[model samples]
Target chain A: MNNEKIRNLKTHAANIRKGIIEGTYAAGSGHPGGSLSCADIMAYLYFEAMNVDVANPKMLERDRFVMSKGHCAPALYAALAEKGFFPMEDLKTLRHIDSYLQGHPNMDTVPGCDMSTGSLGQGISAAVGMAMAGKLDNMQYRVYAVLGDGELEEGQVWEAAMSAAHYKLDNLLTFVDYNGLQIDGNITEVMNPEPIADKFKAFGWNVLAVNAHNFEEIDNAVTQAKQTNNKPTVIIAHSIKGKDVSFMENEASWHGSAPNKEQKEKAIAELDALLKELGV
Target chain B: MAEKIATRVAYGNALAEFGEDKNIVVLDADLSKSTKTDTFKKKYPERHFNMGIAEGNMMAVAAGMASCGKTVFASTFAMFAAGRAFEQIRNSICYPNLNVKIGATHAGITVGEDGASHQPIEDIALMRSIPNMVVISPSDAVSAFEAVKAAISHSGPVYIRLGRLDVPVIYNKESLDFKLGKGIQLTDGRDVTIIANGLMLPEAIKAQEILKEQGIEARLIDIHTIKPIDKDIIIKAAKETGAIVTAEEHNILGGLGSAVAEVVVQNSPVPIKMVGIEDKFGKSGKPAELMVRYGLTPENIVEKVMAVLAMKK
Candidate 1:
């Protein structure tokens, strides 16, 4: 990717981060840390990688994305908002009963969400199903899903991994946001899903790795995944728990804790600085 | 003896017949042979997916395909379909209200030799509790086959509980009138109503005959659709008959009996007796011996009917 393109994607990520902070802060509770961790990847997917239409969200041939680690729905909602799937200002209504933006990604209500997912490990299976459907119909569209590293403790993830490879779903691409920390603590301490690349490889998947924050690396991995035929690809996206915010960086406490007024202002101010630097 | 066919076999036949629809997909969790989904797999190899032994993944996968406009039928033993993969069915299939039909074979004590671990006596309860989930327990082969057709025609998640035992075919194609949520009244009487489903329908029929012999007329109803249960039929039965006896091969706590009772208590409120496994698990035994031991026989239904009739005001 070109420098200007990368810079543009960075601005989208910053805006997504700002939206995530605003959303979780307004809701008074949500997993902001994981949402922040995957903001850049979400930006790359919505703004650059996936072929989705905001106007015709249910287009037959459009690429589908499932937020498997649905706790990070703030990131997905933000990405969708930034990409003009819905109004960006509606991000503040997230997790509220009256708002369509639920705590989890409900595909029925959310304009761009391809699958309803909240319970961990099930979204990848849905993505695999979508890929299988695409193959059945001989469609050119692909299916993408994102999972949290901590979410790997679920047995269904491996089951879905096996199915993806068993069926040779090359059209399916998955990413594990390896942000290290979960709500309990560091995933290694809680439940080690380390050796994630080897595990997926063992499950007959074509495995890749990338810095999730780097749009270039993410783009390259996506290209490689598309190039690889016969086997589904999984990208181990190494990311900080909280990427841009100062105090929230690497903090497990922020996993499900909503930012207070001051914390929200500080987080937004940091993201605003990044936006200013990118001349957005 | 009348023609006997297992509901599971009927379910398999229905899938194979329905495979004529290009968009209909079948998935099995490594129990195609037992669950009888192998019949569909044999005919439409490409359309059928063997999802190994992972029922949860199969359900979620089925949901995904359904989301993409395919009518996906996911089959497995009821133990795994409703018990092991309850959460997957809840969050993935039912919550989204996808076009997925779950053919759960070998439900109840009729699973016999496999014992409690395999028999899913609580499946109907587990399924009906989830919103957007339609639960069906067919009385015989014909109804089971027709229920599959109904499930396909009706969009959203549907759970069809099938049996391992070969029960008597109560209805043939011409005589059967199968609708999604409507219960079929096979016989009408005024003394008491016998509400039954799955393998126990034949028993209820036999019990009705015995009641007639004893000079007590009884109504026989096949309560097939357990979730959006036919409240009108149950309420009408309660009002007219003034007593009810629900017979099933599952636990009395949550199966046909509880469903019928829920309707009767809310709508009409009558004296009701449930003839089921009495909240206990099944042990390794023959289907016939297990049915007798668990009080899922015609004699048991008659006795329950007599007991319920006595309670009627």
Candidate 2:
């Protein structure tokens, strides 16, 4: 990827982070920590990697993205808004009753969302389904999914992983946002999904571990996933619980809790500063 | 008289017939042979997906395929498909109202010898409770084939309950009108109405024969579709007949009995009796013996019809 394109993506990621903080803050009940953690990955997929149409999001040939860790919808919604799927102003309506931006990614209401997913592990299954459909129809479009590291505790993920590999879905790519924090506490303490790459490899996936925050690493992994022809790929992205914000980073308590006004302002300020640093 | 055929075989045959549609894709959770999806699989090997023993994953996969504009039919045993993968069906398929057909075989106590664990006595209840779910329990082979076609033609999530045991066909293919959400009146009477679905329809017909012999003149209605149930026929039957008896191979608590009661109690109150497994489980036995033991026989329907008729004002 070019330096200018990478800079633009970084700027977009920072803005997405801002949107996540703003949305969760406005709703007063949302998952900001995981959302912030996966903001960069969502940014890379929507902005740089996936072939999606902002004008006609329902286009059949467009690549599909399933946010398996659906509680992190704030990140996906924000990325969609930044990618011009919707207006930026709608981000504030995150979990509000009237908002189409639900607590989870609903494919019907949300323009860019390929699958409706909220419950853990099921989204990956949906991704597998989409990939299988694409293969069956002889469609050229690829499928991508984002899963939470904590979400790995669900057995359905393994089942999906097995199916994807069994079907030899090279068109499918998944990212496990290994933030090390779950709703209860540290992922290892609560339920260890470590050796995540090994598990995927065992299940016949082309596995890769990357620094989630690093745009270059994320970009390289996407390229590798596309290159691998026979099997599905899973990029186990090492990330902090909350990447940008000071007190929120690595804090398990922030996993699903919305940021209050003070926390929101601080988080947004940090993101804004990061955006400025990226020369946006 | 129609030939005797198992609903599962009929479903398989229907699926093969429906396989002409390129959009139709079939997935089985390693129960293709039993669920009858193997016919479809054989016909359209590329379109069919054997999802192994993962019902939950199979459901989500079907939902995924449906979302992508493919009409997916995911099949497995009723206990596994409806019971094991309840949440997946609720969240992935029904909630979204995707065009995924859950072809669940071996439903109710007729899944004999496998006993209670294999027999799903509450699959109908589980499916009907969910929103945007069309529940179809065809009476016989002709109806099962027609139901399969109807389900494929209609757009949305449909749960087609198929049985293991061979049931005598009730409807001739040429004359049959297997409309979704509409019940077919087989015999007319004034004493009582016998509403039945799935494998219980023949028994209900037999009960009608017995009722006629006794000068009871019981009406027999085949309620193929359970959810978005044929309310008008049920209400009309309740008003005209004054009493109703619901028969199914499932538990009395839910399934056809509860569904009919829900419609009748609100629209037109009547003396109703349910002929089914009385809040109990099935045991390891022959299909015929199990039917007798579980109170799903013609004698049971006759008894229920008589009981409801007695309570009529």
Candidate 3:
């Protein structure tokens, strides 16, 4: 990837993080830590990797994405807004009774959401299904899913892994946001889902690991996943619990709590400074 | 003796017949043989996917396939589909209103030797509670086949409850008019209404005959679609017939009985008696013996009808 492309991805990720802070702050209660953890990946997907049409969100040939770790609706809503799927001003209405941007992703109401998800361990299976459908229809569209490291404790993830490999769905790509922290605390303390890569290998998936904050590594891993034949690929994205935010970084308490006005300002200011540094 | 065929067998046959549609896909949770989705798997090997004993994954996978313009039929035992994977169906399928049909077989005590663990007496209740879910309890082979056709024609999530036991063919395929949310009236009478579904419908038919022999005219209606239930038919039955008896192979709590009473109490306020398992777990026994032991026989329906008739104003 060129320096300019890298800068563009970084700029999008920083803005997405800003949207996450703004959304959770407005909602009074939303998951920011995990949302920020996956913002870089969400930015890479909507802007760099996927073939999504902002003008026609429901285009049949468009690539599909499932936010398997769906508590991070702020990240998805932010990415969608940034990608021009909907108005950016609507981000403030996150989780409001009348807003389509729900606490979790609802594919029916939300403009660019491929599947409805919130309950952990269920979204990957939907992604596998989408990939299977693409194969059945002989469509060129690919399906992508992002799961949390803590969410790996769900047995359905393994079930989906087995089926994806069994069906030989080469079109499906998954990312595990390996921030090592869950709502309770460290994933190792709560439920050790370590040997995550080997587990995917055992379940017959092509596994890769990358620095999630680095857009070039994400791009390279995605390219390798597309080239892999007859096996679904899982890229373990090593991320921080809260990326770029000063006080919230690596903090498990920020996993589901919204920041107060002062804290929100600090988080947004840090993100703004990063954007300035990127010359965006 | 009337021709007997398990509703599961009819379900499988219907799937195979409908598998001709390129948009149709079948999914089974490693119980294809028992649930009778094997018939579809045999015909369309490419379209049928066996998710290997994971009911929850199979449901969500079916939802995913449906989202992409495929009409998917996901089959499993009732206990697993409605009990083990209730949340997946609620959130992944019903909440999104996907075009996925859940063919839940081996429902109720008629699952026989498998006992309470395998039998899902509350499957109807569980499925009925979910919004945008159409719950169908097919009475016989003909109705089960017709219900499958109706479910495919209808867009959205549908839960078709099937039985392991072979039931008497109650309706002629040529004559049966199977609509998605409509009930079928089998007999017309004024004294009492006997509304039944699934395996209990044949027993209700027998009870209707016995009631007639005893000079008591009874009405018989088959409530195949339990959710989006035919309120008009139920209210009409309650108004015309002063007394009502609801029979089903499921529990009396939230199955057809509760659905009928909900409409009756709201519309006509008729005296109603429910003939079902009395909120207890079923024991392992011969299917016929279990029916008799659980008071799910024609005699039980007859007795309930007589008692309900006494309560009539």
lDDT of each: 0.92, 0.91, 0.94
At residue A100, candidate 3 shows an lDDT of 95
True contacts kept of 1: 0.84
Model 2 C-alpha lDDT per residue in residues B221-277, reported as the tens digit of each score: 999999889999999999999999999888888789999999888989998999888
For each predicted model, how many residue pairs clash, with residues at least 3 apart or on different chains?
A: 0, 0, 0
Question: Mind giving the per-residue lDDT tens digits that candidate 1 earns over B1-313?
Answer: 9999999999999999989999999999888998899999999999999999999999999989999999999999999999999999999999888999999999998788877899888998899889999999998999999999999999899999999888889898997889989999999899999999888899889989988999999999998999898999999989999999998877788778888887878788999999998998789999889888888888998898889878989
Question: What's the ranking of the predictions by DockQ, best on top?
Answer: 1, 3, 2
Better of 1 and 3 by DockQ: 1
- Comparing only chain B with the true structure, the TM-scores of all models are 0.98, 0.98, 0.99
Please say which candidate is ahead in DockQ: 2 or 3.
3
- What lDDT does candidate 3 reach at residue A211? 95
CA RMSD of each candidate after superposition: 0.8, 1.1, 0.9
How would you encode candidate 3's per-residue C-alpha lDDT over B107-158 as one tens digit per residue? 9998899778987889888999999999999999999999999999999999
lDDT of 2 by residue, A95-152 (tens): 8998999988888799888888998989999899999999988999999999999899
Looking at model 1, residue B281 earns an lDDT score of: 78
Better of 1 and 2 by lDDT: 1
Error of 2 at A58 (Å): 0.9
- In angstroms, the error of model 3 at B9 is 1.4
Q: Which stretches of candidate 1 lie above 4 Å from their native place? A: none
